[model samples]
Target: MNTSSTPTPESTSRLSEPVAGAPLVLPVIEEHAVVGREMVETGRVHLTKTVEEHEEALNFTLLHDEVQVERVPVNQYVADGATLPGVRYEGDTMVIPVVREVVVKRMLVVEELHITKHQVPTQESHRVVLRQESVQVTREPAPGTIIPPTASTPAS
Candidate 1:
């Protein structure tokens, strides 16, 4: 038997071919641009006269007074029970001797005041008052000195 090979006509025609371009075209789109601005507002200024008027309209008055008085009494008594002997009661007025003691007291007074103003011409004022009694002290001999008695020194 004999073997032989050969190309078919239908296979040669299918290999010789090229593709064509597309028939439709796409559309283009445009976007809009935006601009922005910032806004700011101013604040009101403070008025001193308005504040003063408001304070005066709402102002309240208050008054106060304080007085202090003290009364002290001094009495004397006997040193020993033998001075008024044979007394029946413990505090018998008849048996007790009435001796009086004299007392000297010093007095002082102090006062203070304050004032303040604002808005329509501000002013501040303060005052202090003090009252006191005068005291006189006298000494016969100077302090820190000792003198020997020659013939004139007397016992106090």
Candidate 2:
């Protein structure tokens, strides 16, 4: 009788499954995060300066010089070669001496006023409006955080 060799367990398993010459390939999916800086407008600050005007009334005293003259009747007699009253300047006033031949002696009176002027410096204060500017930082998320699909990406 013709008979073949008996098959072992190892040989039977090898026949049932195919053997691969190369290693198997698998797809891997990974998520990546990109970080960058971008400039954006958040808020604005404004400053303003204003000027104010006001009126004030002040009262003060001023001094000035004045001169007055008066005439009186004098009855007197003076001899020759005698010196009479003369004109002279005192401070800021002019004085004149008068003499006449009269029957009797008389008296005369004169009045005058002298004044000096000087400049006085004074300091004054007023209110004004002042303004300043400052910057405020605000954190805001970007418009869209989701990344757009690219051509290389597989569609879901």
Candidate 3:
């Protein structure tokens, strides 16, 4: 009595023994859930700018360090134990040695000091009044906002 609806181990042991009711075929199941939506990127936003320009050519230079003192007199007589004439350099001129013990007590190199150093570079030209600074970066739109012009923002 196998009519082929695919249950054959003696019809699954006679449908697992339930013949007292003679009309029991229990199996009923249902589940439904179908939802769909797509657009997920999560991150992107960046804008930055920095600009500065200045041009200046103004010249003024002054340097004067002048020192020149000259006094010369030499009664020149030193020979009785003579190894005394120190301090002498004559490229930028500095020669200082002055000694006197005369009236018959030998040692007279009387008064000799010539010190000279001079450098004077002076160019004074005055005409300068400078104050110039300009900077503007603006993107203000959020009251019925609409901004559509770029190449450094030019649309009145």
- Please provide, for model 2 over 22-136, each residue's C-alpha lDDT reduced to its tens digit, 9 standing for 90 to 100: 5555558799999999987443445454544455544455555444554434434444455664566666555555654443443322322233234444554555544455555
Question: Tens digit of lDDT per residue, candidate 1, span 24-113?
Answer: 444467999899878633333333321111112233344443333222232333343324223232231122222333243322112111
Model 2 spans > 4 angstroms off: 1-45, 88-95, 99-156
Q: Rate the local accuracy (lDDT) of all candidates.
A: 0.36, 0.49, 0.75
Tens digits of per-residue lDDT for model 3, 44-74: 3434544444555577888998988887898
Pairs clashing within candidate 1: none
TM-score of candidate 1 to 2 decimals = 0.19
Which sequence of candidate numbers ranks them by lDDT, best first?
3, 2, 1
The TM-score between candidate 2 and the true structure equals 0.31
Backbone steric clashes in candidate 3, count: 0
For residue 121, give model 2's deviation from the true position in Å: 20
Candidate with best lDDT: 3
